[model samples]
Target: MLVQETLEFDTPGRGSTDITRRVTEVVRAAGMTTGLCNVFLQHTSASLMLCENADPDVRRDLEAFMQRLVPDGDPLFVHTTEGPDDMPAHVRSILTGNSLNVPISDGRLALGTWQGIYLWEHRTSRQARRVTLTIHGE
Candidate 1:
């Protein structure tokens, strides 16, 4: 069986926002004992990842690094219809990813102790983003 759900989020920059708990909630609600959970961001300027959740600094550092790598404005992009962050956001999402696959066992996500699922928003302002979660298993 496959179960799917959509979630919304607000972000401030091209960075990661932890969504581990929400994913877990969906997994539990799905009542799947064994399967694969696939999470996808339905946008061009956002992505997903599994990263360290134990430390806030980790996320901060990642955000900082991404900001430095992409910055806010660039002279080469032609798709600047959304502002300076428009192209950079897309680039950041491309650099990161758009989806994630995680293991599920005994109706729970098999994540590491310090690991967490994140929604990497690659926009400069707070925007409503949608995340689609799909579970395939018994």
Candidate 2:
């Protein structure tokens, strides 16, 4: 069996949103006993990852590191039509990624105790994002 759905939400700007619960809810709603759960972010300026949800500091540090590694208004960037942070956002996405694939077992996500899914928004302004979840299993 296969189930798919699209989630739309507004991001509060540069930060990570813990979306583990929502994703799990979707998986549960699908009622799949076991399969592959694939999540795809429909944006270039935002990315996804599975990280330590137990510590907010981890999220903060990662954001800080990305800002330092890809500062906005860099003279080397040529894609300036969107804004100063535009190109930097894309760079950050490249550094991270745009999708995640997790295994489903016993009707639940097979994530570690401390691990959680996150939507890392790289843009400086509030933006709407879309995520597609595709589940394939029994």
Candidate 3:
């Protein structure tokens, strides 16, 4: 069986939103005993990632690292029509990713302990993002 759904989320700019529970809910609702779940972000400036959820510092540190690695308004970027952070946002998303695939077992996500799914917003302004979940299994 295959199930698919699109979910929308409002991001508060330049941060990560924990979406593990939301994804799990969809997986449970799909009623698939075993399968694979594909979480895909429908934007170029945002990303999907599996990160440590136990400590907020982990995310904070990661954000800091990314900012350092890809600072906004970098003189090297040529795509600045959307502003200084625009190109950088796309760069950040590219460096990270826009999708994730997780195994589903017993009608639940098979994520490891402390591993949580996140919608990482790279833009500096609030934005609405769409994510598509595709489940294939029994």
Candidate 4:
């Protein structure tokens, strides 16, 4: 069986958005007992990940690290039409990636105890984003 849905959410800007519950809801709605749940972001400036959800600091620290690693306003970036954050956003997205695939077991996502789904917005301004999920299995 294959089930799919597009999830849209507003980002506060340059941080991680906890999307575990939403993705889990999608998976549950799919009614797949054992299979793969794939989440694909539809934007180049934002991405996804499975990270530690137990601590807020972990999210902040990771975002800080990404900012330092891919600082904005580089002279070499030709894609300046969207401002300094544009190119850096793409870089951050490249680092973190734009999709995730998780296993489903017993009608639930097989995520670790401390792990959860995160939508990392790399842009410095608030923007809307969408992630499409597709579940395939029995």
Local distance difference test values of all predictions, in order: 0.89, 0.94, 0.96, 0.93
Q: Score candidate 4 by TM-score against the native.
A: 0.97
Best by lDDT: 3
Candidate 4 error regions (>4 Å): none
List ranges where model 2 is wrong by over 4 Å.
none
User: What is the full ranking by lDDT, best candidate first?
Assistant: 3, 2, 4, 1
Q: Which regions of candidate 1 are displaced past 4 Å?
A: 12-14
- Let me know the TM-score candidate 2 reaches against the reference structure: 0.98
Report lDDT (Cα) of residue 58, candidate 3: 97
lDDT per residue (tens digit) for residues 60-124 in model 3: 99999999999999999999999999999999999999999999998899999999999999999
Q: Residue by residue across 67-122, what tens digits does model 2's lDDT show?
A: 89999999999998889999999999988999999999999999999999999999
Task: For candidate 4, give the lDDT of residue 28.
Answer: 91
Evaluated at residue 123, the lDDT of candidate 1 is 83
Native-vs-model 4 lDDT? 0.93
- lDDT tens readout by residue for model 4, 1-138: 999899999999889999999999989988889999999999999999899989999999998788788889988789988999999999889888999999999999999999999999999999999999999989
Clash list (residue pairs), candidate 4? none
Model 3, clash count? Answer: 0
Superior candidate under TM-score, 1 versus 4: 4
Q: Pairing residues by index, what is the TM-score of model 3?
A: 0.99
